[model samples]
Target: MINSSPGTSQTRSITQTSISQTRSFTTVSLIEMWERFGYYGMAALLVLFMIDKIGFADDHANLTWGAFTALVFSAPSIGGWIGDKVLGARRTMIAGAIVLACGYLMLALPVDTLGFMYASLGVIVVGNGLFKSNAANLVRRIFEGDDARIDSAFTIYYMAVNIGSTFSMLATPWIKDHWGWHAAFAVCCGGMLLGLLNFALLRRSLAHVGSAPDDEPLRGSRVFAVIAGSLALAASTVFILQHKQVAVACVYAAGVAILAIFGFMLKTCDRSERAGLIAALILTLQVILFFVFYQQMSTSLTLFALRNVDPAFSIGGIALFTWSAAQFQALNPIWIMVLSPLLAFVYARQARRGRDMPVAAKYALGFVVVAIGFFVFGLSGRYAVEGRVSSWFMVAGYGLYSFGELLVSGLGLAMIARYVPARMGGFMMGAFFVATGVSQYLGSVVANFARMPAGNLDAAQSLPLYTHLFFGLGWLAAGGAVVAIALLPLLGKLSRAHQQATQAASRRESLAPAPISLNAKNV
Candidate 1:
């Protein structure tokens, strides 16, 4: 039997509480960074690896790249539900990491040709879908009700994501060049193992906290049903891969099914929650636009870096900063790390001083910034065509887009917790990820144009496509920002109501009786 010493027990309790308090922000960030590092490192090299190392054509590699990332983001919705209803976040996270680790190791195996590649990628996709969203929800669990710090926490967590991604990018190319493609994938496996270890060490600290499981037995059964459904869906995907025309029908049907479910869910919520949920739904639409552009990382943008920019030239006799295409992804995170803290401080100071801007307004500003970034991207394309494009253009675009991320996507996690009820908070977070996944799918669709064979399109035909892509993004960002500006007066009203709700919670907490005297004499 396990026996606890009084001193040890007391120390453990204190450690546990401290860990719980910080669970939302710190643990998530660390783990997320590691995961992103592995995932992005793989992503940064994926298309190129398929085309150059594996001998697939650019178009074929692009197709696989888009589909894989889309699936990775999508799997979490199912994973989150499992965590919330039965397995709990900690277990689900553990399972996901294990699956991901196994998937990476599978990739590292020296296998035959196209069939092995497809099978290995399928495993990774399923594993990633389970891993990505739930990990994010795990971070969201740490906040108290309506704490404005929620968004800032996500921004910080996102910073870790970038940092991990940066290191992976920097490392993968070097490792691959020195060893081989298999070694590069092995790096991803190494990260998954490290992340798994960190999480295992921290699990006890998160006990009794984080996306608690449903107490009802029926809830468990329902979750199993969903898992079964997901498996069936996966099987269907396999079938569609074999049969082309059915894929078209499945996409349309999925869209309709999703819209119908959303309508029903909105109608089911309480009035205040429904109002907030509707706003969130609008934000989701906006997020789709953001992800459409962002997803270019694994698509058109990867190809651009590969085909165009010359690797850094060595100075004197030494190799100076010559890097892989994957390293470019590092810039986004670097920007996030620099900007998140400053934005958090500014917003917190404004709140303390009673001069804070509305959430919608901040988000609106973010969208506008995003448009500018895309415009910069378009400009870079033209400049490249003119035979003199600076690497600084790509750098500038990432900076602008990073700022835009701070404003819109970074703020979203906090907004979800603030607006959602306690019981449904995790589910709503799952929904947010679902929205992100869907948008990525849409981005993949858009990316099809960008990856089209140069021989297929005349120069004039390509010009319209590029123009529409960049300027369309610009117009959408600006229009969305304008709409958010108009909604600020209303967002202010919601913010006040949310503040009052918080104050009421605080008042209740303050009204509770003081703890009994610990050292009282016996009667």
Candidate 2:
């Protein structure tokens, strides 16, 4: 018979603690899903709306979109810093959600002026910075220590992200088609509010996860000072983007300087520190390329769909496939939902067989898939002839890209934690964000080139230009894959010390006496 003494009560308490922690994680995952719904919903329409409604040229819309998205990546570094060193994760997330809500509201204003969009994007970027990293960090806190479950947990969490995107993708574009972009923007605002409400409801359960480190609270009055400095910088950026030539130059320069700091700071570290940072840098660069390819969802691909993709379909006598170009954005998340689970199972089975795929291998595979996708796009462009190619081709490419995302893009944050030391984990996470920021800028450059008029070519003859661009993108992805494969041997070298450390941990675990049950220990 099971013991029913005071000791048993103590064991029950420990079990309860674990149960509550798991539930809190579930709450966090739900909130993250809702937050993604809001963000991706807005993103689906942001560029097209800027071009069509705001009357910017395609080039201008693409550049501004890139800049705004780059800033979104940049804010995470600052947000991670603040969450770790000042406001704590929970409070920072609270502040971020509030700011995000306000930003969306600003976008909803009927005027739709330049200032409103800039200010609104700024709020969203800064807010995302504060909230995004903290939410991931809190997930880490849910588990007591590094273990295999964390991997599975992240996979489950990532599924939630795509699942959330699925609903928003379907809804946002439909709303924009019938009610206009304002209604679409408002829907995202409502999604943001829902995330906030979810967070508030779960606060009691999540208290242990998001508190800032004991040593990291904001210095007296410094919080206000940091806020002011960030605001000034944002205002300056808005002024800068107004100048066409300077925007690209400025983003590149800023990206280099930020990364150099990370590089230099890592160099000064102890061996473990240096190794972890190296791993982080590699992970970060891979992610940068991941986003660069991913961001096309809003720019070249959207335009491609608008101009060339034939969408002749009828769904139960209702016309389908003639939806706005932005509506194609919904397809990505839907694919992710279908693909991620299958991929996760494959990965788990490999791990169980002691042949687990390395992060680098997955990243390399992703680039290869991206290259193939781009090649397909080029083929589609070549055959488009009179007008848009079949929408099914774009769908096929997006499907491949979505699978590539499951392999790398969605695996990033988890990989960072696995590789980095606990002390500087957040900083390394920031470094990952910085890499993505650079990629966003680079993607803009690529998009700008794609939109540029080819010499001696009339508007009627621009198909070759797009074909060449797609071919170029395919080459870039292929080149990246080659380089990444060449560098594969180096990951093992870099991870050697980590492997040794893990082995040491395993030895200690084997030799040490088993931990007493909580009941006996308490008694």
Candidate 3:
């Protein structure tokens, strides 16, 4: 019984097609911003929470943090599919909001048990899956055929995400320092509730955006049932995967399964699609490498600041403020917020001059810059003597990392849209995130090398450990850059071929005759 009345539909369609014409885009941005705020708020506190409250060893904490982040980003694939095929985006998104708030509520209990933590993470993962991708999908639906505006819209959308992160990373840590850990976590829960309210209140604006376009659809209560049942099954699967004996096997199995599915899809697709898929797979590897470097912010990098960095700032000999270890994470997004516009202009200028860089070359550049960040990080240890390193060190590292992030991540999404057929775009996008999720876990594994001696490492041990890890990370990223550069020419050729095929197909479709009526078909 979705309203298909002409006037209502027309109003919603106009809003969807024109970002400035309605409040819909703003509503979606607020939802995204608030949701990210809640998520990052919780994330800012997680490793510290595990270490101080749960009394987990550094190694165990790294593992748990890795698993948590991996699952959080990973769920989007299944969640995206569920929304598309079963519940539809709007309903799935609303349901996810409720669950996400619940997940944070669980963490706000002040209990220090691993069981609750794991379960809470599982719930959040599921909730994030349902919410994150579908919310972005709604943005696409809003802009529909307005391809020119969609990129700009996503740039704005990503800025909102960074804005939320910047605020939460700064606020949550301060709250935890002044109030208490549970209070800080409670703030995360409250933020999610705020997001949920925004979503519900703005439903009218989004009414035309997320409704399924397919002929056969799961409607009303059936949608809820399918989502609920699927979530339960998925949640149970997460618990089983959490088992230590099976965790690695499960990760491998999941990776293989996803690969096999995509391989089958490629086999069945037209020639151009297969070429695009191949190119996408190649590009996805570079993205995974970038995220591996990026995710260190949460793991080894956070720990580095906590154990070694001095966070005090002063202006003209007057003490300004001291930032908490977790607050150090804000630097990445803060840099993003400050630099993205400048970077956008540079990319545009390059394109205008016919000096537009290939995506692979950009990826190579991103990897190289990240390597420099890690190299800077490695050098920071010498600047740390008694237990404290200069704050400028992390600032410099994040500055470099942010520039690389600007170059790669935004274009990664554009690549999918550029190379793949519209029919397969969503699936490819999900795969991109899945690669990210995998990298989060791998990043943790890389971080394991820097794990403190049993509990917390004194400066003597920490300096060498972090130094060694950074050196290795720098080299790892440099290696990825080399590989990407080596593959650039091939990727370029495949991408051009896909673009040509897509243009040809579009032209044919444009020229094709309309379908006949039943009587005309008989005649």
Best by TM-score: 3
Least accurate 10 contiguous residues by lDDT in model 3: 209-218
Q: Against the unseen true structure, what C-alpha lDDT does each candidate score? A: 0.68, 0.75, 0.77
Error of 3 at 114 (Å): 2.3
Candidate 3 lDDT over 201-259, as tens digits, reads 87678766664633245466766576576568457646753564455555566567557
- Best-fitting candidate, measured by lDDT? 3
lDDT of 1 by residue, 1-523 (tens): 9899999999999787555667645666777777887787787777778887678665567655655555565556667667776667656666667777877887777773666666666666666656665676666666655355565566677677778887888788788889988889889989988987887776655664555552333455765775676566455445543343454454445455446545766888655456666656666666766777777767766555555544563446465666566666667777887887888788777767767766677788898898898788777756554332445676788899889987877877666666666666556666666566666656766766655464555444454455456666677677877877787777767666656665666797899998777576833
**Candidate 2 wrongly placed segments (more than 4 Å):** 1-21, 211-223, 244-246, 314-321, 452-462, 502-523
Number of the candidate with higher TM-score, 1 or 2: 2
Sequence-dependent TM-score of model 3: 0.89
Report how far residue 10 has shifted in candidate 2, in Å: 12
lDDT of 1 at 457: 51
Indicate the residue-level lDDT of 366 in model 3.
87
Ranked by lDDT, the better of candidates 1 and 2 is 2
Better of 1 and 3 by lDDT: 3
Residue 472 of candidate 1: its Cα lDDT? 65
List ranges where model 3 is wrong by over 4 Å.
Answer: 1-25, 141-152, 211-221, 224-242, 315-318, 347-356, 518-523
